[model samples]
Target: MGAEYGQEGLVSTSCDIYSFGIMMMEVFTSKKPTDEMFTSDLSLSHWVSKALVNGVTQAMDSRLIRKDEENFFAEVNCVSSIFELALNCTAESPENRINIKDALAFLQKIRLEFLVKLSEN
Candidate 1:
């Protein structure tokens, strides 16, 4: 389920997209929606959004940070782009979200960019 669940109290394909976005965020951030830090309206997505204002490094899982790796910045940029897609998918309004087709296209572009960046190093 997604924000729509709270709004309309119904499950839908859009809701599935929202859920997929949430899972994507969770996988990259390594945080649960019910984490102790996510209390009082500070949901996982909200927290990630706030932390991302500082940098993608602050929003991603520590294990995935890889600050010392040769491609660290490239990796972070890739993850950040993915987060952007997740945010687009998890928009509060289902109608405002990126459709599955666009999301896939965006992801493919992100991957291609990441590979190009990796090749540069």
Candidate 2:
């Protein structure tokens, strides 16, 4: 459940989007929101957000970093786009959050760009 869900006690599509964002972050960083390292001030979201300021490479899983060295720049761009989408999905205000359709379109665009980059290599 997201903060909005707890704060408002409302069930809506935005709630599901928030959960999806959390799952995407977990998949990328291999860190869960409930991890022992996460506290009230230092959460998984905060950690990733800080790392993203530096580069997506800093936020990504070590395994991905090792495997995608050939396409590092392209991969980082794609991952950064994905993280931005996740943040939008998890926005505190439901009205400000992106819907599933737009999220999917953004993801597809990222994928297409990645493929084009791969072909160029």
Candidate 3:
């Protein structure tokens, strides 16, 4: 599956995106990507999914040093958008996964937005 579906089929980019998404979630939560805490129907992806359904604020890692409302809102929006893209990249069906170029563009946009927001401060 890894070879045919992930490598030869040109799904490597999508698989990497899935992994990157998982990593981003871990970074935001300060938890291992596949820790036991996320077991029992509470996988990291599931938690993120629920949070996205409700609101991005609910998904933020409490450890992150949020400065103020402006920064907080900006961060929330950035993370939320990233998580949404990640979710799409990690869908069960290969056909549902997003291409790598799109993922890179999304991440770049997020980074640029953060930079702009920081500069405005």
Candidate 4:
């Protein structure tokens, strides 16, 4: 459930977007909202938000670590954009979150950019 949906039982596209954002964060960060590192003040979203200021590497799953990979920089940039998108999707307010259509479009762009970068390597 999204923040609003979880708190107010308001079912809508926002809730589904929130769910998608959460899944993105979990999949990319390899950290669950209920992870031991997260507390009442710091959730997965919060963690990612903070970690991003430092660098995408901090928020990424260890398995994705590849500092020497041919497309490392592109991967970092793409994942960073994705983290930001997830954060937008998981906004505390439903009204502040992005729609699924926008999210999909953004992802398609990221995918294209990533593919181009990969090919360059």
User: Can you write out model 3's per-residue Cα lDDT over 1-121, one digit (the tens) per residue?
Assistant: 2223644566565567677777777777666755777777677777888889897667777767475666777777778887887777667666677778888888899899988887887
Candidate 1 runs further than 4 Å off: none
Write one digit per residue (lDDT tens) for candidate 1, span 1-121: 6866887798888898888899899999998788898888788888778767888778799998677899989999999998889888888888988888998999999999999999999
List TM-scores for all candidates, in order. 0.93, 0.91, 0.73, 0.94
lDDT of 1 at 104: 92
Candidates sorted by lDDT, best first: 4, 1, 2, 3
Per-residue lDDT tens digits of candidate 2, residues 5-34? 798799999899988888899998888888
Best by TM-score: 4
TM-score of candidate 1 against the unseen true structure = 0.93
Clashes of each: 0, 0, 0, 0
lDDT scores in order: 0.87, 0.84, 0.73, 0.90
Work out how many backbone clashes candidate 4 has.
Answer: 0
Model 4 misses residue 110 by how many Å?
0.3
lDDT of 4 by residue, 1-121 (tens): 6867667778998899999999999999888888998888889998899878987799899788589877789999899989999998999889999999999999999999989988888
- Return whichever of 3 and 4 wins on lDDT: 4
Q: Is candidate 2 or candidate 3 better by lDDT?
A: 2
